[model samples]
Target: MAKFFGNLNAVLVGGLAVLIVIMFGLHSAVLGESIYPNQLFRYLHVLCGIMWIGLLYYLNFVQVPTMPSMPDELKPAISGHIAPRVLFWFRWAAAFTVLTGLIVAHLSGYLVEALTFQPGVVLIGIGMWMALIMAFNVWFIIWPAQKKILGIVEASADEKAAAAPRALIASRTNTLLSIPMLYCMVTQNALGV
Candidate 1:
């Protein structure tokens, strides 16, 4: 058990297998085949969203704040090793979240109406737009800047100096946007907001 849990790839695959089993076990409620694309995409969206936002919070709440206080030598461990890997997952999760969300929206037949901010879907549309913007920030803004900041790309000293603040501000902007994004996602359907 410890060995399995210690291997992230194994853990993720095992967890997914368990989830599939549980879903199949609830056959009466799930009717898995009948709800294939829509349900599957929605599930993927939520799963990707959790990973995206979870990393965002980890960066904002834990990593960024803690960096300034770390010893310079220790900082390399995070900046060189951890940040790159985390950003890899972060950016891909952001992309997948948007992709799966669009798939779910299209499959449910409201992609146009929602994007147009039609009355019933205004809140979700707002959330979707916010998420799209955040994803853009993750991919185009944050990742590029992070590459420079983390030395994944060769940058002039001046460029590296510029990159850090750029990445930080974009990440902070996403963090701020996440609050309302989450609110809209949860409240849109439930409260008819």
Candidate 2:
């Protein structure tokens, strides 16, 4: 059990196996029907969204604040190793979240209505547009700036300096948008809007 849990791949596979069982066994029994594509995409969307937003919060609430106080000698550990890994996951999670979310909306037959902000789907449309903007920031603005800030790509000292604020502002914008975005997503179903 220790060995199995110690390996990330093994743990992920185990978790997936459990999900398969629940989906086929419990879910089917409860719903009396197989899972639909929309449901699957919704699940994926929620999963990826968690990773993306969680990382975003971590960067804002923890990493950025802590960095200034961190000792210079120890900074490289975070910048050289940890930050790169975190950014890789962060950017990919952002991409997958958007992809899955769009698929969910499309499968649910609300892609056009939501995008266009039609009457009934106004809440979800707002959420979708916010998410799309955040994802665009993640892929285009933040990631490119981060590449410079993290030394993943070549940049002069002045260039890296310029990148830092660009990345921070974009990330902070996403953080600000996340609050309302999440509210719209959660309340859309509950309010029956």
Candidate 3:
């Protein structure tokens, strides 16, 4: 038990197993019957979106602002050790969030309507577009710039300097877009749009 709890992979699997058990108990023999494929996609979309936005917030609200204040020597610890792993999860989460969201929309029979913003799907469409833009920033703008800024790719001092602000701005743009994106997503479902 101690060994299982100590490992992150094990802990995650154990937690999920517990959740399945609880769900099974609650639903009894009808456990899988009430769960729809779209619901699964929705669950996955929300999970990935949380990871994506949570990391975006951590980068914007915590890491970026705090970096300038850290002593020069200590800065390397975050840049070298923490940022890389966080970025891996961040970018993948963004990708998966978009993928799962699209799957949900398609499964629910609104992919075209949502993308086209057909009268009833305008709000969800807006949220989807924002998410797409945010995902694009994560992959194309932020990740590329971050590679140089973090020295993952060889770069001159001037290049690294240039990359930092690009990454910062793109990240900040996503943060700004996230607010309206979240509102649209939540309200569309809540208000029955």
Candidate 4:
């Protein structure tokens, strides 16, 4: 159990297997049909969104604040190793979240309406647009800056200095957008809109 739990791939596969079993059982009993594409895409969207936003919150609430007090010698462990890995998951999760969300909207027959902010889908449209902006920040703004800041790309001292604030601003912007974005997403269903 310890070995299985300690291996991330194993744990993820095990969890997915469990989910599949549960889904099949429930769907067979209740719906008497296969899982819908929209439902699958919605689940993927939620899963990826959680990873993206959870990492964003971790960076803002934990790493950023804790970094200042960390000793200089200890900093490399974060910047050189931990940070790069976090950003890897962070950017990809952001990309997948957006992709899955778009697929969900498309499969649900709201792609055009939501993108155009049609009357009935205004809340979800707002959430979708905000998520798009946040994903853009993750890929275009934050990732580039982070490459420089973390020395993944060669950067001059001044370049690294500039990247820090750029990344920080974009990250914080995403964090800010996530609150309303999440609210819109969650409330849209509750409000029956």
What stretches of model 2 exceed 4 Å from their correct place?
Answer: 28-35
lDDT against the true structure, per candidate, is: 0.92, 0.92, 0.92, 0.92
Q: Could you tell me how far off, in angstroms, the CA of residue 82 lies in candidate 3 after the best superposition?
A: 0.1
**Which 10-residue window of candidate 4 scores lowest in summed lDDT?**
28-37
Q: How would you order the candidates by lDDT, starting with the best?
A: 2, 3, 1, 4
* TM-score, cand. 4: 0.94
Clashes of 4: 0
- Candidates in descending TM-score order: 2, 4, 1, 3
lDDT of 1 by residue, 45-125 (tens): 999999999999999999999999999999999989999999999999999999999998899877888889998888989
| Per-candidate clashes, comma-separated | 0, 0, 0, 0
Estimate the TM-score for candidate 3: 0.93
Worst 10 residues of 2 by lDDT: 28-37
Error of 1 at 187 (Å): 1.3
Off by over 4 Å in 3: 1-4, 27-35
Candidate 3 or 1, higher TM-score? 1
lDDT against true structure, model 1: 0.92
lDDT score for candidate 3 against the true structure: 0.92
